[model samples]
Target: MDVIGTSGLTKRFGRVTAVDHVDLRVPAGARFGLLGPNGSGKTTLVRMLLGLVHPTSGSVELLGRAMPRHGAEVLPRVGALVEGPSAWPHLSGPANLRLLDAAGPGGRRRDRRRRVQDALERVGLGGIDRRPVRAYSLGMRQRLGIAAALLRAPELLLLDEPTNGLDPRGIGEVRDLLIALNEAGTTVVLSSHLLTEVEALCTRVGVMDGGQLVLTEDLDVLRAPTGHVLVRTPDPAAVVPLLDGQVVGRSGDALVVRGDDAAALNARLVAAGVAVSELALQRRTLEQVVLGLTGTGSDRVDGGTT
Candidate 1:
C-alpha cells in the first residue's frame, strides 16, 4: 500500500492556485523528495497533506485512509518537522519532548520517556538532553526538532528543510539519520530546494514548477546527460575550429564542449598540436535542466515574451 497518495489535489489562495490537479504516490518505505523553487506549492501541498490547509478541490489519501475526514486517525501515526524547529525556547530539550508525549494520544507512561531518550541519543543529543533549547546551537536545535518528531514512533515521517540551519556536519548527520530511518521501514517524504542534497538522498524526486508537478522520475533518470567532455588547453583559439562539438562555456583556459562523441575531438586536439592539460566528462546539473524547463532560460514559452 502507498504510504501517501494524492489525486487531482488542488488548492487555491484567492487568485492563485497553489496546487493544480497534482497526482502523487509515495510507496511505503520509499525516500520520496519534493523539489521546486520558492512559491512553487511544495509547502502548500505538504500543508494540505498534514491537514493544516484546506484544498480548494480534489482528494487526498494517506496510508489507505482518506484525508481531512481521516486526518485524525492518520496524524497520530505520522511525525513531522516542518519549516523550522517549533520547540519552546525556554524549555529544556527533554522537557519539551516529555510535554509533547504527554499531550499526544495514548502516550501516558515511562515508555514515552524512554523513547524520548532513545530519540535524543539517535539524533546525537543524548549528552545535552537536559539543556535549555535557547542555549543550543542551530544544528543542535534542528536535531532536537527531529527527536521530538520521532518520540511518537511514527511510521511516516515528513521533513521540510530539516537541514535548514545546519552546518556541513549536521547536514550529513541528518541525511544519514533519514536514510537509516527509511532502511528500518519508515516512509519519508522530504521537501527541499537544494538540488545536490536531494540528488544525494532521494531515490525518487517530484519536480514542481509554477504550482504544477512538471516531472516525477527516479534519480538515475534525472541525472544530467553525459554527451561531451570538458577540455583545458593552452590555446582555445587554435582548437575551436578543429573541435566537432559546440563550445558551451569558457572557464579560464578550459572549454566546455557538448556533442555526440568526444573521443574524436580528443584525437583531433592531439593531432592539431594543442597541449591539453585536462579532459573530463561534462555532466549537466539538475539546476540546468529545471531552469530550461521552467522558461527561465532565453527560450520563452511563447513568442518574444522575455
Candidate 2:
C-alpha cells in the first residue's frame, strides 16, 4: 500500500501559494526523498499531509484514508519530525518521551517506556535520560526529535531536514538509524536540501520547485545517465575527430566526453594513432538535472500546477 499519497494538493496563504498542485506517493518500506530549496514549498506540503495545514483545492490521503476528516485515524499511525525540535526546555529527555507517549494512542506506560528507551538507543542517545533538553546540543535535539517520532511505533515517518545541524559522525549515525527503521518495515518520507545526502539514502526522489512537484524518478534511473566516458590523450587537438557530441572540458592531457558510446570513439582514437592513457566512465551528478527541473537556473512560472 502507498503509505502516503497526494493528488493535486495545494495550499495558499493569502495571495501567495505555498503549495501548488503537488502530487506525491510514498510506498511502504521506502526512503522517499523530497528535494528542493528554501521557499520551494516542501515544508508546506509536509504540513498539509500531517493535517497541520489545509489545502485550498485538492486531496491528501495518509495510511489509505482522506486527511483532516480522517486525520485522527491516520495520525496515530504516523511518526513525524517536521519543522524543528519541539520539547520543553526544562523537561528531561525521558520525561518528554513519557509525556508524548501518554498522548499517543497506546495507553500502557511500561510498554511506552520500553519503546522510548529502544528509540533512544536506536538513535545513539542511550543513557542520557536525566539530561535536560535545554542542555542538549543541536545534534542531540535532532535525535530526540526522531525518538519522539517513533513514540507511537508508527507505520509512516515524516522528517524535514533531519540532519540539518549534525556533524559528520552524527549524520552517519542518523542515516544508519533510518536505514534500520526502513528495514524493519517503516515507510519514511523526508525532505532535504542536501542532494548528496538524498543520493546516498533515498531509493526514489521527488523534486519540487516553486511549490510544484516537477519530477519523480527512481534514484538509480536518475544516476545511470549521468555516467559519462572520460578520456585523456597526450595530444588534446587530436581527440576531437575521435569523439561525437560536444566535448565538456579539456585540460592539457585530459578531455571529458559527454556520451557513453565509447566503443566507436575508441575505434576512431586507434585509427588516428593518438596515444590514449586515461579512459573511464565518469559518474555524473544529478544535481544539475534536479536544479533545472525546479527552475533554479531558469525563468520562474506563476501560479503553475504540476
Candidate 3:
C-alpha cells in the first residue's frame, strides 16, 4: 500500500500559493526524498500531509486513511520533524523527550522511558551527558528532535532537512540509520533541498518547483544511462572526428560520445591510436536531472534597479 498519497493537493495563503496542485505517492518501504529549495513548497506540502495545514483544495490520504478526518487514528503511526527541533532550554535531552512522548498518542506511560532511551540511542546520543538543552550544540539539538520523532517507533518518518545541522560524519550516520530503518519495513520520507544528501540516501525522489511537483521517479530511473560514454584521453582532438557527431560534449581532454557501449568505444579508441586513459558509461547525475527540470531555486531574489 502507498503509505502516503495526495491528489491535486494545494494550499493558498491570501494572495500567495504555497503549494500548488500536487499529486504525490510514497510506496511502502521507500526512502522517498521530497526535494526543493526554500519557498518551493516542500514544507507546506509536508504540513498538509500531517494535517497541520489544511489544503486549499484537493485530497490527502495517509496510511490509507483520510487526513484531519482520521488524523486521530493515523498520526500516531507516523513521525515527523518540521522547521526544527524545539525544547525547553532548561530541560535535559531525556527530560524533553519524555515530556513529548507523554503528551503524544500511541505511547504508554509504562514504556516511556524505554522508548526515550531507544530513540536517543538510535539517533547516536546513547551516551550523552545530563546537560540541559541550552548547553547542547546545534547538531545535538537536531538529533534530539529526530529522537522525539522516533519515540513511537513509527511506521513512517517525515523528516524535513534532517541533516541540516549535522556534520559530515553525523550526516553519514543518519543516512545509515535511515537505510537500516527502511530495510526493516519503515517507509522513510526525507524532505530537503540538498541534492547530494538525497542522492546518497533516497531510493525514490520527487521534485518541487514554484510550488508545483515537477517530477517523480525512482532515483535509479532518473539516473539511467544516457546511452553515452565519457572518455578522458591525453589526445581528445584525434578521436572526435573518428566518431563524428557521436562526440556530443567535450571539456579539456574529456569527451562525451554517444557510443552506447563502453567496450565498443574503448576498442574504437584503441584502434584509432587515440591513447585512451579513462572510459566509462555516462549516467545523469541527480543535480543534472533536477536542474534540467526546474528553474532557478527560490533562494535567489532579483529586484528592478534600473
- Alpha-carbon lDDT, every model: 0.84, 0.85, 0.92
lDDT of 1: 0.84
Candidate 1: worst-modelled 10 consecutive residues by lDDT: 292-301
Model 2: lDDT equals 0.85
lDDT per residue, candidate 3, 1-306, as tens digits? 999999999999999999999999999999999987678899999999999999999999999999979999999899899989989989999999999998887678999989999999999998888899999999999999999889887899999999888999999999999999999989999999899999999999999988999999999999988898999999988987899799999999999898678998788789978898899988899988988888765544574321
What is the TM-score (0 to 1) of candidate 2?
0.87
Taking every candidate in turn, the Cα RMSD to the unseen true structure, in Å, is 4.6, 4.4, 2.2
The alpha-carbon lDDT assigned to residue 294 of candidate 2 equals 70
Per residue, candidate 2 scores C-alpha lDDT tens digits across 1-306 of: 888889999899999998888888888888999998778899999999999998999999998999988987889889899998899989998889889888867558768778888888888888895879999999899889999998777899899999977899989988888888889988888899889888888999999888889899888877774546778888878777555555788778888887777776677687889888877767656687686677643334675443
Q: Estimate, for each residue in 179-229, the C-alpha lDDT of model 1 and write its tens digit.
A: 999999899899898888887898988888877889888777767557767
Between prediction 1 and prediction 2, the one with superior lDDT is: 2
Give the residue spans of candidate 3 off by over 4 A.
Answer: 271-273, 301-306
- In TM-score terms, candidate 3 sits at 0.94
List candidate 1 segments past 4 Å from native: 106-108, 233-253, 257-277, 295-306
